[model samples]
Target: MVLDTQIKAQLQQYLTMLEGDLVLKISAGEDKTSRDMVELVTELEKMSPRITVEHVQLERTPSFSVNKVGEDSGVVFAGLPLGHEFTSLVLALLQVSGRAPKVDEAVIKRIQAIQEPLHFETFVSLTCHNCPDVVQALNIMAVLNPNITHTMVEGGTFQDEVKAKDIMAVPTVFLNNENFAGGRMEIEDILQKLGSKSDGTEFANVEPFDVLVVGGGPAGASAAIYTARKGIRTGIVAERFGGQVNDTLSIENIIGTKVTEGPKFVASLEGHVADYDIEVMKSQRVAHISRKELVEVELENGAVLKSKAVILSTGARYRQLGVPGEEAFKNKGVAYCPHCDGPIFKGKNVAVVGGGNSGVEAAIDLAGIVNHVTLLQRGNELKADRVLQERLRSLPNVTVLTNALTQEITGTDKVNGLTYVDRVSGQEHHIELEGVFVQIGLLPNTEFLRGTIDVNAHGEIIVDKHGATSMPGVFAAGDCTDTVYKQIVISMGSGATAALGAFDYLIRHTAPTQELVGV
Candidate 1:
């Protein structure tokens, strides 16, 4: 029989009243409440006795034992048992009943086998909620394996510890006495590190380098070439061969190249750097960076590297719309890269926010494919080049709305429409569309270098004419740095300059003096 809505509502109310810091006890074969149950029932009986309370029947089985008190003694209730509140409930229940949930046998065995307690402390802040997932995963591991004692320390509370660990961002997990995971981490990755069974079969010794380039973008690749050609032992560390340029649709101005797609041009640049004897470590992230006599870098997988100088070439990410429903409908209907998701919305209406070069280019590109393009601008005019502005104005399918702001994205499951406010008229209107592309600009990924170097108010790393920052033995190049002209050609030129500056610093500091014996 189906339960009536009124009865369900009443049952839910009864369950809500039952939840509190109280111990519940149960006994068998009695219609009336037992003494322990009566105490709990008496407390909650005033709230709602009609909710139903009865003695549970014990099963007659050989496996069951009387020594285990809670054969049928515990409170069963509704509502999702989750979050911090649920953890408190579980602890409370265990205190009264003297029984905990059964853990995995293999995991328990592994915990018992561990000789030492693995102390893991992860620093996190409410501003960085993304860290909680990592913390929760580690907590689960701690539960399964008692050998691991994990603690989540709020970064703001421990200001001294944060300064000591150089905690720039959240999700920084420290394993044992070493900094383990920095950013987002996978479960298997942490597990492998804890359970490494290697016999040094995949190990290799690397020599110390004069300078190490940490990215292979236009700036980083160029830095490696210039440093290597100058007779310095240079190395390049890149998660990808070409960095963000590989995702660009087209590149028009790279000095020699008039018109080239991002991937092909980046491939050529990679080849140019690969011709030298410099070591290239692709698909790797620098997990830890420390300075002693020589700067030391630790890879994500525990490989150690030493260098005299280091260059940060990590670029930036596309700025998000930050409007409601933008993140909810991210891949389904909302997108940042027009070239990546534009084709899917062909013959469909789409809205492009931001009137900059990327936004104007996206509008021009979408006008050809989409049924109609609404170009919304927060200001009176577009901020792109004159040529691009002229091209956008000439498109018949593109409608440029000046002094317009996207107030909110209206969609239940995916993107269906958008609400925009007219800045000039103070009128709000909803546009029925299938997709929205946000190209507001870019945000520097210099979060990793927060206290390491000087950054401008806009969060871009501050550098001099030669791409040298205020920090000694450290340099920054590409979009990460505060260069007014953010073009491919300019990045390459700055990268070359930074490389030369690094070379000079290395020679002056490390090279030995010559007595001029020939003279």
Candidate 2:
């Protein structure tokens, strides 16, 4: 029953690509965890002859090992492999069969360059959809490097380890017995944390830039393209290129485009940025920024770089409800991303905060997976488009509450309920649920400025129509700024404006060459 007809068909197709036989040793038990795993692999065995499924009872050993060829090369799944973790199970099966790994070349090169061994242990549960992202990132890293050994343990069955570690969340990763990360993390972040430096030497002593952009989202991409077109020295320092855009599911309000996914739009942004001369420092974070005659930026890796003018387009992050248990239960039934963690809540009740398009869309999406969805909005009515509202109402499993303010996310270790107050009715209500998804709004990513630039009360950088900051020769744009509408196209337009403003300032004060002819 774990593997539906469609999933069984897909597994049959995938298993045929296996180069070697895979043994799945599942524990014989009536427990849900053990039975769920058994049902999954038994279905696979019926479809693919290459997959060997065995049933055994192991009181001391793990519940199951998917490449049961031994501890030398195997992954353990102590719980059912449902949700998005199903993909991880499939990939691990393919990998154990000597399949080529799908990892970034740069990452593989770093892993290949490692002198010391890296041991990674990731704890996960069957219901944690985001666990696969971390597990796969480390799994592929281990696959690329022989010295790297990785293990994925299902927290549900390993109750002793979970209790001993005081683990209340999923996707808890540890490197060398030290905490690495607990939730969704990028491979680059993992590499940097492991002290595996990028391919290039440190950025210290590097040549200064005429204009430096601090983020690599759409706003930063646009600013870089505009600055590069002006034939000026431009560079961008970013932890990631796509930013929050990568976490999005649908992007429909991009002006010319009717619709596109986050990854596609991000790829297009990268492709467009590649058309110009820009110094892109990926996986680098701006630790500090100071402005004297020149704007000096310090990176977390102790690298320093100077710029004549800087654009503050760092963008924003999803705002938390700031209620009790919101932080305590993060990744422990409290999730922000529906696309990344929705499947984990299948057949379980959950709630969504906000009446905006994102929140409503998330509710509608979750209604298809979870048993039920309760959407809370602080406003009198939904702020989403009429079509989105209509589609949301069309779903039977969704309940919308207007003018409801979330009071707290409640649970002992994981979220089990959500409390909210109705502003109009002056009454409080609580919904029993396993997960709460907050899509209320965004908080600008201008904290790194540390009061160096003028920011609004909401911590957003104040920018004029042309993206000029309070400081001369400096500019700001995108979600980091005080823009009325934080759309992708608007951010791009603001970035171009900031670049033009910078160009105008450079020509008038810094003295420009023929590059200033257009202005």
Count of residue pairs whose backbone atoms collide, per candidate: 0, 0
After superposition, candidate 1 runs with Cα above 4 Å error: 1-204, 298-304, 512-519
Instruction: Please list all clashing residue pairs in model 2, or write none if there are none.
Output: none
lDDT minimum window of 10 residues, candidate 2? 68-77
CA deviation > 4 Å runs, candidate 2 = 1-140, 150-180, 192-201, 511-519
TM-score for each prediction? 0.59, 0.74
Q: Residues 182-250, candidate 2: write the lDDT tens digits.
A: 766667878877777663445655788888988999999999999888888889888878888877767
Error of 1 at 3 (Å): 66
Q: Give, for candidate 1, the lowest lDDT window spanning 10 residues.
A: 59-68
Highest-lDDT candidate: 2
